[model samples]
Target: MAAAARLAWVDATSGVAGDMLLGALIDAGASLPAIRAAVESVIPAAVALSVDEVSRAGLRAARLRVEPLIESPPHRTWRSIRALIEDAELPEPVRDRALAVFGRLAQAEGRVHGVSADEVHFHEVGAWDSIADVVGVCAALHSLGISRLSASAVALGSGRVRTAHGEIPVPVPAVLELSAGWQVVSGGAGELATPTGLALVTALASECGALPPMSLESTGVGAGTRDTPGRPNVVRVVVGTPVAEGGRDELVLEANVDDLDPRLWPGVLAALLAEGASDAWLVPILMKKGRPAHTLCVLAPVERAAALREAMFRETSTIGVRETAVRKTALERTWVHVPLLGATVPVKVAHRDGEILQATPEFDDVAALARKLGMPVRTVLEAAVAAAVDQHLIPGAELP
Candidate 1:
C-alpha cells in the first residue's frame, strides 16, 4: 500500500504562477531530475524542459520554464486531451493520473460554458506546454510518494485576462467554477490562478481550507514568473505525516446546574478526560429561575458515549443532559520525546498543513515529576514546558 501523503497549498500571500509553483516545489525538495523526466515522458521529444534557479520576492526558487511545442493552438477537444493522455507512452499510473486531472478540468469547463463534459474544449490548458506542466506535477508527486493533496485558500487574482475568447472577467468562469468550496483569494490584481492549476488543485487536493495543523517534514517552494509587490511570488507546498488516528462524531453532553458545588467541577472534568472524552469544559450560565449555574459540556468520542453519560449522572445533580453526535475535523496527533528540565518526557504533537502548530508536554509526564518532587502535576507540567521553551527544546506555546 502507498504511504498516506498530503499536499497543502500555502496562501502565496502575494501570488502564484505555474513556473513559480514548480520552482517552489523543487525548492521544497521535489527532485529536479525526476520532475524533468516526468515532463519528458509525457510530451513530444521536440519540447524542451528548462529549469533554473531564480530569485523572486527576495527568495531563491527553482524556475520551471517550458518552451512552447507548437506555434499554433491545438484547439484540442476534451476527447483529444483524454486520448493524448491515453495514447502517450507514459506509465499506466502516470497516464491514469493525467486523465484524472484532465477529466476534472473538462467537467469544470463544461459547467462554466453550460455544455456537457464531452463538448467542452480546453483552449488555454490544451496547449502543449500546459500538458507538460500538468502531467509533470502529477508525475513529480507520484515520484515523491505523495498520495494526498490540500491547499490554503488559493490565491486566485481578480482582474481581466485576455484568452482565446477575448478579455473575460477576472478568475475566468472555468477557474471559478472548478474552485468551488475551496478558499480562493485575490492577489496583486493579476491572473494568479490558471485553469490547469485550479483543476489540478481541485482534483488532487483532499482538503481546501486552512493548512491543517501538522508536523512539517519538508516544504517545496514552486516559483511563478510574475513579480508582484507585498506577496512572495511563489507557492509553498508542505509535505508531512498526518498525526490523526481514526476518530468519529462525538456526543456533546451539556447541562446547566445551579445547585452543584463549584469545587466538584474540577474533579468532574478530570474524570471525563480520563474516561475517554475528547474534551470537557464548563461555562457560567444564568438559568431561567435567575439562579446562577455552571453549564458543563462534555465532548466524547463515540466509543465513550456511555461512560460520559454515567459520569454526568454520578458527578452532577442534573436530571438530564442533552447529548448528540457532532462531527468535527481534528488534527492527527502523536507523542514525541523531548528533554526538559533534566528529563526526557513525552510531548504531544499536533499538526495541520504538515506543520507542527502545537506541542505540549504530556500531563502524565508532569504527574510523574510531581510524584517525584511532591509538587502539583499542573505546576510540574507548566514548569517543564516553560523550561523546554526557554531552552528552545520545545516549540511555541506551553502546556494547556
Candidate 2:
C-alpha cells in the first residue's frame, strides 16, 4: 500500500501572492536552495530569489523577494511560457504543477481579454519576478512532499489599481474570472489578491474554507509588503499528516420543511450533492402545530457549506437553515475487483492499521451484473461475496 498523502492548508484571509505563498512554504521548512535551483533550471540567471524575516502587524514572518536581473524582460505569451516550462529540467511534479498554474492564468486572461489562451500575453505575470515566484512556489511544494492543498476564502481589495491595461477595479477581470466558484470578500482597500496568486490557489487547492483538521506538524507565515494596522498582512500555511483514526471536520446543515411537494425531495437532495454536499437526506419529523415534515440534512466540508446552504434555500421550502460543526470518523477504504458471472464486480474493503474490518460487494455493480447475466440480484450479490471470500477479502483477514 502507498503511504498516506500529506496535507497543506493555506490561510489566505489576509490575501495571497505567489511570492507570499512561496515565502510561507519556505518558512515551513521547504528548502529555499532547492526552490532556487528549480527556478534557475527554468530561467537561468533571469532573476534572484531572497528571503528575510519581516514583521507584519508585529507578527514575524518570512518575506520572499524576487528581483529581476534583466533590464527589459519581454512579455511572454502562454504558448512561450508553456514551452519554457516543458523544456526546463525540473522534477515532473513541479513541472506539472507550474504548468497547471500558468494554464489557469492563461485561460482567465484569455476569457477576460477576449483572446485565445495560447495567444494571450501575460504582461505582469510573464515578468521574470512573477515567473520566479510561480516556479519557486511549485518547487517548494514538491520539496515539502505536499500531496494535498487547500485554502480559505480569499481576501480581495475594494479600490482600483493600475495594471497593464491602466486602472481597473481591485479584483481585476482576470482575477474575477479565475475566482469563479470560490469564495471571496472585500478584505481591504487595495489589491490584496493578485491574478497570479488567485491562479495558484484555484489551480492547486482541492478545497477552500477554514483550516482543516490535521495532526499538528509545522506552521509558517509569509508576510506581504505592507503591515496593515489591525490585521496581519500575511499568508499562513499549516502542514501536517492527516489523522488516520480520528474524526475529520465537517458541517451539518439542516432545515425543516412541511409545505414542499414530497416528490421534489429527491431532486433537492440531488441538487445539494451536485453543489458539493457530501451527503443530503431527509428525516421524517413533526414540526410546530404537529405538521408532518421532513428534516433535510446536508453533510458538507466547511469550504462547501456556503454553497450547499444556498442550494438548500433555493431547492427546498424551508425558511431557515441550521448549521452545526461535526466530526466524522471513517474507515480507510480501498476496492478490489472480483469476477462475477464472467464480469468483474468491485468490492469495497474497509480497514484500519492494515487490519481488514469489512469487505462488501458494491450493490450497484452487483445489480448491473445481475441484469447483464439474466440472474437474480440476490444471486449476483451472493456470488460476488463468495468470490471476495475466496480471494481472502473478508473481515479479520489481513490487508496485504
Candidate 3:
C-alpha cells in the first residue's frame, strides 16, 4: 500500500509549473540528491538537476534547474517519453506518477490536435527539463511520503504567449483542455498554469477545494520565473498528517418530485452513489397544494456536483435541482480482517489522532456470512465485533 503520511495541498495562489513544483518539494525538505538520482536514471546523463534557494518578490523559495549539456530537440513522441519512464529505475509510485503526468499531456495534445495519444509529439514538454520537472516532482513527493494531494483553484492568465505552435492565447489550448471540469480564473495577463503544471496537478489531485484538516508538517514554496505585479510568482506545497478521517468540503444536492413513481427511489439513490456520491437518501415531504413527494438528496465532492446532477436528472423525474456547499468532517478510516463463523469478515475501523474510535463490521457482508453459515445477522455481526475486541483493534473503547 503506497500511501502518503497524510495530505499535500498545493496553493497555486500565483501559478504552477513543473520546475516550480519540484522546487517547492525541495524547499519543503525532500532530498535533492535522491530526486536527481531518480531523474537521472531515466533522462540523459548530460542533464544535470540542481535546486537553488532563490527569492522572488522578497519571498524565498527553491528553484529547480535542469541543465542539459548536450543539444537535443525540444520534442519527443509520447511513446518515447513513456518508454523512458518505464525503463527508469525509479520507485513504483514515482514511476506511476511520472507516467500519469506525461500521459495527461499526451491526452491533452491529442484532444487539441485530433490525434491519438501515442501519436502525439510533445512540443514544449519534449525538452529535457520538462522530463526532469515531471519525474523529479514525482520523486520528491514520493520521497516525502506525500501520497494524497489537493489544490486550491489555479490562477489563469490572459494575453498571448508563444508556444511551439506559434503565438497563441495564454491559458493555451492544452491547458484549457486539461482543466475542463476544474476551477480556473484569469488573474493576470500572462500564463499561470503551464501545460506541465496543469497536467501534474490534474493527474494527482483526488480533490480540489479547501485544505483538509491535517496536522501541519512542512511547507515548501517553488518559485516560478518572472514576477507578477500583484502577487509573488510561486507555488506552495503544504505537507501534513490528516487531522481526522474522511475530511474536506462536500456539496449537497436536492431535488423534490411529486409526480415520479415511488418504486424507482432505490435505483436512483444507487446511481448517485455509483457516480461518487458520499451518501444519498430520500426524505418524504409535502409539496405545494398538499402534494406528497420525496426529496432526493445526495452529498458529494464539489467536483462531482455536475455529475451527480446529471445522474439525478437522468435517473429521476425532476425539473430542477438545488445545490448547497457543505462542510463534512469525518474520521480517517482503515479496515482489519477478523475471523468470524469459521471465515473472515472485514471490520471497518475509524480513527482520530491515531486512536481507534469505532469498529464495525460491514452489515451487508455480515448478512451474507450469516446466510452462508445459517445464522442470524446479529450473530455474525457480534462475532465480528468480538474478533475485533480480541485483536485489540481499539483498546479502551467499548464494544457491543
Candidate 4:
C-alpha cells in the first residue's frame, strides 16, 4: 500500500514572509543542509542560510536568516531568473515548485508595472536572500514530503512601506493582484505580508481556510524580525496526516435560469468545471406560471467559490447566484492498472477505513481498448471487471 499523504496547514494569522515560512518548515523537521544545498545548486556561493532559536512575543520560534556573501546582488529580470532555475541541478519537484512561486511573482509585478512578465525586473525580490528564501522553502517542502498544502486567510498589514519604486501603501498592487481569490485582512500595522510571501502562499497553497482536521504530528513556529510585545510575529506550520472521516468545508452556488437554450447548458456546465467547480449539474424544475427551468448547482471549495461564481455569471444568463456553505465527506480513492485483453485498463478504487467499498474500471479506457482490439465495448468492460476481481479489488476486500 502507498503511504498516507501528509498535510501541511500554514497558520499565517500573524503574517507570512518567505523567510518566515522557510524557518517554520525547517523547525518542523526539514533538513537545513538539504535546503542549503538546493539553493546553492541554483545560485552557488551567492548566499548562506542559518537559523536561530528566537522569541516572538512570548513564544519560541525559529528565525531563518539569509546572508548575502556578495557585495551587491544584481537586479535580475524574470528571464534571467527563469534561466538560472531551469538550468540548475535540483530535484524535479523542488525545481518545479520554486519556478511556480517565482512565475507568480513575475506575473504580478508585470501586471502592476504594465510590462510583459519576461521583461519585469525584480527589485527587492531580486536580492540573493529572497532567491535563497524561495528556493529553500520549496526544497524544505520537498524534503518534508508535504503532499497537500493549505493556509488560513492571510494577514496583510496596513500603513505604507518604502520600496525600490517608492513608498507604497501596504498590500501593494502586486500583492493585491495575487490575493484576488483568497481571503485577506489587515492584521497589524505596516507591511505584514510581502509580495514574495503572498506569491508563495497564493501560488503553492491549494486551499485557504481555518485549521483543517488532521491527526496532529508536529508544529513549527517561524519568527519574523520583530518581537512585538502583544502579538507574535510568526508563521506557524502544522504538519499531520489528514483525518479520513472528517468532512472538508465546501460551498454550493445555485442559479435559476428560465430563458437559456437547452443546448447551452452543456457548455455552461463545462465552463463552470473549468473555472474550479468540483461538481456542477442541472435539476429540472417547474417555476412560477408553469414555466420550465433548470436549476444549476455548483459544488466548489471555499477558496474557489469566488471565481466559480463569476464564471457562472459569465457563462449563463443568471443575474444572481445564491451560495451556501457545505461539508463534503469523501472516501479515500486510488487508481490501479489491470491487464485485460492484452491492454492495460485503469480501475478506480474507493475505500473507507481500509476496506474497499467499490472498484470501477474507467469506461473511457475500456472503450479505447475495445476499439483497438475490435471487440465490443461491453465485452471489454466485463473483461476489465473480471481482471480487477482477479486482483482482489472488490467490496469488503482490503484496499490495495
Predicted model with the maximum lDDT: 4
**Which ten contiguous residues of candidate 1 have the minimum total lDDT?**
391-400
> Model 4 segments beyond 4 Å from truth?
1-4, 246-400
Task: Identify the leading candidate in terms of TM-score.
Answer: 4
Name the weakest run of 10 consecutive residues (lDDT summed) in model 2: 301-310
Q: Look at candidate 4 and give me any clashing residue pairs.
A: none
State model 2's lDDT. 0.85
In the range 160-276, model 1's lDDT, one tens digit per residue, is: 989988999878888888777666778658788888877666555545567766667778767787655556677777876555635444567787788888888899899889877
lDDT of 4 by residue, 204-290 (tens): 676789898888888899999988889999999998877864587677888899999899999999888887788999999999999
TM-score of 3: 0.65
Q: TM-score of each candidate?
A: 0.58, 0.65, 0.65, 0.68
Better by lDDT, candidate 3 or 2: 2
Listing every candidate in turn, what is its Cα RMSD in Å to the true structure after a full C-alpha superposition?
A: 17.1, 9.6, 9.0, 7.9
**Model 4 lDDT-worst window of ten:** 302-311
Instruction: Give Cα-based local distance difference scores for all models.
Output: 0.68, 0.85, 0.81, 0.86
TM-score of 2: 0.65
The residue-by-residue lDDT of candidate 3 on 244-264, one tens digit each, is 455466677888889888888
Candidate 2 lDDT, 242-359, residue by residue in tens: 7653566677888888999999988998888887787988899998889999989999765455446546756776645666667778899999998777789999999999989999
